[model samples]
Target: MKKEKGLQKATDFSGIKTIDDLHQHLKTNPDDADELGEHFITKLNNAYAEKNKTESDYEDLLVALDEWEEKPEAASKIRNTTYEANYLIIGACIHNHIVNNICFPGVTAIQRETGLSRTTIYRHLKLDDFRPYDKLIRGKHELMAKRALEHLYYIGVVDRNAGALKTFIELTGFSKKSSASNINNYIQINNLKITREELDQLPKEITEQIAELISEGLQAKDCDKKMEDMTT
Candidate 1:
């Protein structure tokens, strides 16, 4: 009796609370000890399997998150590019030009200054770098000079106090040109290592246009500074 009591105490310490609970647990309850033990073992195995699967799932999720963090630019293509994005870019460039006094002439002004037609001005706006300018011109039923002017204001091209649309088309002083070492640094940082073969694959006209723009931009460095000095 004392040995049974000690055994009972040990089982109780092991968390087998009651005899009925113990009987149920040990598969020695009344009639189906072996079958009941088998069921209980199966349940224990299932619980362990579920815990391992959960841990594996969590590890996979962490790895996926790490990969995403490592390559944000890869995720960028997941987003669709839209006309609105084009507008914002052009708007920013135009605004910068306006603020710096690199202005394009008006409808008649472009005609007088560049010897380009109003239709040409519209066409110029269609270019990727000038899309925002084009959107301003084409957004409404009316020929809204105000909308174009407002976009310029938003881009910080026109001074609020001056209340005038600065030209977004032209800047001066291009003869003394310098290479943009900064652009090379940028290309390297962005991993945009284009080969000569890739350049050749581009349409000849586009390649020429890109070359001209780069040459013009490098030539026009410090153009606004020269203009400011001339004014002073």
Candidate 2:
């Protein structure tokens, strides 16, 4: 029970938008690094999954913005603060750019693409820690579980829509199939080595799932452990 409280406390990375914020946090509670990093990974993963949801790039962001203006309370897709929304949106841009593009686009390009000023992009992205920069006020874990489904598409185990399914799984625990049984039924498995930088092309949540699956069939190295080892 006490652990849950500490965890809940640790999850609050609201103000941590910059690497300097992370540095200050480390100075005070150096021990929380692992937990902090885990939260960071979770945040990025959530944002990435959010990025994947829309078939098109920043178009949905504009739609979400319109919804917010009409009814802030009903803007389920947008974040609370302007900064928070920008952060998530920028994270979406970053996640989208890095994975989808062969060449990395500069912040200036990101500004043009998302209609966000370069300053806004810099602020939320200055992260050097695990503090979550949330865009969605609710449904974090359910969102993250969806990332695991992306592996199905990556590995050719399922169609592209597979990644959209994890919202139904409880992050607390789910009685899904074994890691191996989940993917062996398919052909042309994408190499899911956790150590490969390509794995970073996927969100940490999906990477972790891939690691678990690959670990069983082949003597895959403890790459997934490395991926989950947020302390470092």
What is the model-wide C-alpha lDDT for candidate 2?
0.49
Worst 10 residues of 1 by lDDT: 169-178
Candidate 2 — which pairs collide?
none
Q: Tell me the tens digit of each residue's lDDT in model 2 across 181-212.
A: 34332224476333223433568688457544
Q: How close is candidate 2 to the true structure, as a TM-score?
A: 0.26
TM-score for predicted model 1 compared with the true structure: 0.17
Task: Give a tens-digit lDDT track for model 1, residues 1-232.
Answer: 4554344321122343233444454443333333433443443344334432222222222233323345443222211122333334345545665677778434454334333334334444656644433343365524465566556544433222211212221111111231343232211216566543454466856644654554455446657778889999
